[model samples]
Target chain A: MSRRRPSTRTVLLAGLAVTVVLAGVVSFYASGHPDGLEYVAHSLGFGDSAGPHVSDNSPLSGYGVKGVHNARLSGGLAGIIGVLLVGALATALLYAVRRRAPRD
Target chain B: MHVPDGFLTAQTSLATAAVAAVGVGIALRGARRELDDRTAPLAGLVAVFVFAAQMLNFPVGAGTSGHLLGGALAAVLVGPFTATLCISVVLLVQAIAFADGGLTALGTNVTLMALVGVWVGYGMFRVARAVLPKRTASVPIAAAFGAALSVPAAAATFALLFAAGGAVPIATGKLLTAMVGWHVLIGLGEAAITFLAVGAIVATRPDLVYGAQDLRPDHADLEIRDGVVV
Candidate 1:
């Protein structure tokens, strides 16, 4: 018997679900240690030279919503927002490019 | 690796910014060839998936964590041109909205992760594919090898940039060693993730996989019999 291929919608929705879960819930459990670059910078004595981000005032700075005391909720909300915004922007850009692509 | 503000000299930052802009412009044009209406949205979804995956920083070693750059994975799923754009979009969003990466350093991040990562990973994937068997299984294995190398390669590039024009003076030799060493560990995680993700996709939806496109059967009725058309 031949297997039925998943529709694009099904694939997309599945991807969305995975993104939501990973970004929203599992992210909170990520290792809190400094990343590779940051660790090296600190050990090498240049980590102190790092300056503040220009968008530090953004409501979603540091992947946490501003003024939300609940860490989990804030981070989860920020993650969800990020996934949605990225999805939207990517879709728009890709669609625009597709429109511009020469038809074969 | 996301370079923070005040890390590199203004001149270096500006130079990288110019390079990144040119790279993105080229990618924008090239991505047009890779994307069609049906697959355009797949590029977007790839970005979203990468962004989310980047958030989960798994520990590599020595109190240091690493996350998926998604370059190899994206290039295998989508074409490299579209993968570059996808990663660029992710970095841009992270910088502008989340402030995860520095605004001034956006160009550096784009160059390192989007351009360098994608090209190196994709190139390595192609090289590996050339040597490996042409079976569909080879796609993910090649992707894994590529992803493993791309992390350390990006780290080396950052070290080179820093050597050229770091805002603060440091020993370049030691810094390079440390950066490359740590990233080599991180590259293992990159390989694992890339392998699993690409393997799963190739198994379930070979049609959606860009790198494995050649592995797909041409058509049901177009079989060759004994090297002769029948």
Candidate 2:
């Protein structure tokens, strides 16, 4: 089969689809308790026992978005923010790489 | 395991920091060469997809939920070199911006999640592809195995880190057993998610999927031969 170039539309749509699904998942059905690792730590004694963190007072501590009501919604928003931040960062890095590449 | 701050002693953290620095330095150099015009954007997309995919929590027995680590997915989509860079970037951004992980333990996180996870997962993928039927189905199966296995492998890496720099005087064997056991279950979810993602990419853009390249032409031929063209 002859290769066809993927349109920007495809990438955008796919990216958006993935992002929305991620937000929905994070918003709706995340485990409320500590994850397996954390649970193990707790059962074995060490959970909540972390030494003082320098940024413990950060606004977005413990996966909670400050001033956001509805815990699930806060987490969902945080997830969305995470996606955007990471996506933008990755895109910029790649863009720089692309820019520096020798033109064909 | 996302090592929270203060989990490891300062000495251990600093030591791993040096190790991680070297690992990342190597990865950065490799990425500069491996990620070309075609591969670079795709790699960035893989990272974004991984960032998004990691949010989807699948149930692991008994109400526990886990997400995709994506080390396998990235390695399968890109190469090991680029995969490491992609994961490191994601973890770094997560630690700094979201505070999802500890800054002090960033080195440990990257080494385990990026280096160990990607290599182990991709290695499994190559082996599975070599053994399985050379077709589109193999892509999913291999991806599933690679993704699933990466969890325990990563858990083991964390266990090692904990052994070296653990805050609590926990038994290494017990910790490894517990982590590897739980992660083995979580690995199933990782496999499922990875299979679906790889299947989607293979279905739509086989050329873009690094792991699917070999199977694409043959699979497409088989589809035509069977009168079931995609």
Q: Give per-model CA RMSD.
A: 2.9, 4.8
The lowest-lDDT stretch of 10 consecutive residues in candidate 2 chain B is B216-225
Q: What residue pairs are clashing in model 2?
A: none
lDDT at position B137, candidate 1: 85
Flag regions of model 1 displaced more than 4 Å: A99-104, B221-230
Q: Cα lDDT for residue A58, model 1?
A: 94
lDDT tens digits, residue span A23-103, model 2: 645445765556667767786777765665555565655555778888777777776776677778877765664326565
Candidate 1 has an fnat equal to: 0.82
Q: What pairs collide in candidate 1?
A: none
Off by over 4 Å in 2: A1-8, A24-26, A98-101, B216-230
Candidate 1 per-residue lDDT, tens place, B85-105, comes to 999999999999998877889
lDDT of 2 by residue, B178-223 (tens): 8898899888888888888888777666667778877655353455
Candidate 1's error at A33, in angstroms? Answer: 0.6
TM-score of 2: 0.87
Q: Interface Cα RMSD for all candidates?
A: 1.7, 3.0
